[model samples]
Target: MRPSLGRFGYPKSVRGYAVQAPGAPTLDVFSRRTKWLQKERAARDAETSRKVDYVRDEVAARLCERLLDIKRHFPHVLDLGANACNIARILTRPNPDSYSAAPVYEPLSSRVSALTAAESSRSLLHRDEDLPFNNEIAITRHLLASDETLPFAPHTFDAVLSSCSLHWVNDLPSVLTQVNNILKPDAPFMAAMLGGDSLFELRTSLQLAEMERRGGIGIHMSPLADVRDVGGLLQRAGFRLLTVDVDDIVVDYPDSFALMADLQAMGESNALAGRDVPPIRRDVLVAADAIYRALHGNDDGTLPATFRLIYMIGWKEAPQQAKPLERGSGMVSIKDVLEGQRTGGKSGNR
Candidate 1:
């Protein structure tokens, strides 16, 4: 049975863990409350919030493009970790410019019969409800739920899509399992998250500054999943035909301070567990700014911050799905095929 939500919208079991016996082992890596607060604060400022949404919008469009490639219609889709309805907006809005270039492209809304946008922050979810697309036929429901604990029955959704979220989850493997569980058999799960190399410039600058100023360093940036391990995580979660790839989006800022401000507005600030350390001293921040410019400043008097987005596609297994042939079943020999090609000669007849 699923645990009921306790105060602050977390499962009762999660709150219980907070008071567990001392010295007990735990798997939690992020403070859910902190993340929720960050997102809520970001939503409160409408103008600044929209500014940082460009990244999410770009990623959402790319994810929707991948869905268009598959020739299947999703009767019901779940937008897990839906932040301000990025995926929903992309799916519902028609891009006449792109349609003119490629008439073969079909609108994502036509393919998606219905959508449920689920987000952890109530403020953000409420903000999503205010979007004009909610009146469209695509978005059918808005759910307030955490990615850590998905409240849904098995085989509920025909497909699942997430954009610019999931990296903040404390237990990613568990969440992926829930995603696979809710997806109907043979349904595809498409998502994109920040990879380990994301924001390396900021991370490095902060580390060096802290070390020089305080004689030590602290975790100023949240750790992210490495692309190398994403496929394994998907397979472990029972997702089949896994596809994983990475893309880097570099945005130039006037300096590190401006970049940090954007990150805060984007609700991408650090929310690591036990992150109670004092904020970076002003002197340290100044030193870090200098170091950042010296190390990675562009020739145009700006700094380049790279966000590496890791894209993953996996499918729920079904009996009808195609499977790889047995290893020794191949009749053709690669050695002979290569030799024939090298000689530019015919085989049996010649």
Candidate 2:
């Protein structure tokens, strides 16, 4: 079992870990977490992204060719937290050539109606059940809400592709276990999730200001777990062909408050279940905004909010002869490993 952590919880990047409340206290000095939200964020994520429908759909289109190459014979697929059903939308509109890499595409999603008029689906399975599809299912962005475990059979899916999810979950190792069990030998699993440094400005500013105002400290923002952390997770999860990539998009906002509102709009709020909940008074909120502007704002009074995204691609291992190395040693060839340039971590291990 992992070691116990206090109110701030554990993640490498969390700067201020103050449990005691600040100088001018506002609300009750929140000792324990109040009523639990019961992992209710899933329903909220579905409802909010309708306005951003095109973004997901466009993501699918961009990955079409690469996704096609991952599997042959139209492997059974499952799209998780499939709010927009964008994969189905792109599948129907195949390239000009009559022949493509995929066979009959099956989209099993929660919001069944979200599938475009042109797309097809096998069945609608609940997120907490054994998927309706027999084997070789693909999923994305579904189980990352609150570290809730996934339900599926071992060695099931031929390949899994997840786009823009997994940042919210804390049970990285458990999630990887489910992935390894459900995926077949040597099957590919690729995903895109926000990285630890991903919304640095937005996350750090909020955390610091909260610390400064309330004299209390706990991770207030939705802190991102980094790429190395993810790569290590994949290794522990039993994936062999592992590759993690980042796409850092620095989004500009007029003010830090505007950026904070955008986070709410995206339904990506902090959900540290069993965390301390101190009341944030009106003045505290006002002070936080000012400090956020002071630290992260640019010369023209605009704040730079970084959205560093990580694209990870890994696969279950096919049976091979084992040539054991030293405990901390690797059998990998160095030249072949520098496949892509990456930041952070010691050398190019990730």
Candidate 3:
């Protein structure tokens, strides 16, 4: 169902884990304790010297492509859930290393102003948090804000972009609808979120191991949004000319343990509020490891883990932009076209 722009209230707060109504779709699932998730992410960022922000880097690269394709420079950009201001650095950094560089795009640092947020304002950046982009210009403004509640005014930005972060929000549609309302007319919006297929092998192995040992599988991974549902979400949030695409990135790991470690380091580990089980037993871990190796191990001894990044781009509706054609206005008939193709095939056979 489409989210209404007229709705102004945020989601109701609940203590601990809370489940929706019995018949509600699984996508509407809730997480009651995202505070720990936020803290975990902040702690991860704080520990790293350079911040191994691969997902954020990938997100910035894709947003750069969108900037190139649209041929528009947004003077006032907002980086939603902008962890460490990575997108800001990508869009602004001069003479970035080849490993993370894009085409010589416009200098967003000079022209575009942005607001970014971490779990808290203090935890936004690494070592260079206080330092500006360079000596001359200011970096993206960092704030303390949660996805469920944005502390900004309406029509505040020309563009809104996020990377690998929105998937963790408990009330995604509400956050998105708020984003829609705050963007100026004709503004560009893009985001990348983790998709449903991420960590398939690990999820499978864990479930199998848990069921065998404890007669049930507890939540071990966060629920991910399906790529199929995102386009509809953009429309529901009142976006136009929406485009949604998925990029599947497979990384080879020495084993499932290494993959899990990386996930923990990246603060992408399970933080589901509905998880009812206690910490997994050592036997369960060994069994899951064996199961993973049997089911998805590589000949070279490296296991593969998939990270599906679903990228969505849309525009705030504008009066000047073109709209889709009305139903029944098409000039061609499908039946006639099929018949013509059939006749042509028969003539070719003769």
Which candidate tops lDDT?
1
User: What C-alpha lDDT values do all the predictions have?
Assistant: 0.86, 0.53, 0.71
Each candidate structure's TM-score, on Cα atoms with residue i matched to residue i, is 0.86, 0.60, 0.78
> What's the lDDT for candidate 1?
0.86
Instruction: State in Å the error of residue 100, model 2.
Output: 19
* Model 3 misplaced stretches (Cα beyond 4 Å): 1-51, 93-121, 124-137, 331-350
- Decide which is better by TM-score, 1 or 2: 1
Give one digit per residue, the lDDT tens place, for model 3 in 1-350. Answer: 64434445654444586778763244435453454454445455565524546666766766655665665656677777766667766766553334545665455455554444333333544435655653333445555545567777888888888887788777776778888998999888888888879889899999999999889987878788999989988898899988899988788888888777766666566777766767778888889988888899889888888888899998889899878889999777777677768777434221
Candidate 1 lDDT, 260-330, residue by residue in tens: 99999988899998988888889999999999999999998899999999999999999999877899998
Better of 1 and 3 by lDDT: 1
**Candidate 1 structure, TM-score to reference:** 0.86
Q: How many residue pairs clash (N, CA or C atoms closer than 3 angstroms) in each of the candidate models, in the order given?
A: 0, 9, 0
TM-score, model 2 to reference? 0.60
- The alpha-carbon deviation from the true structure for residue 140 of candidate 3, after best TM-score superposition, in angstroms, is 3.2
Candidate 2 backbone overlaps, count: 9
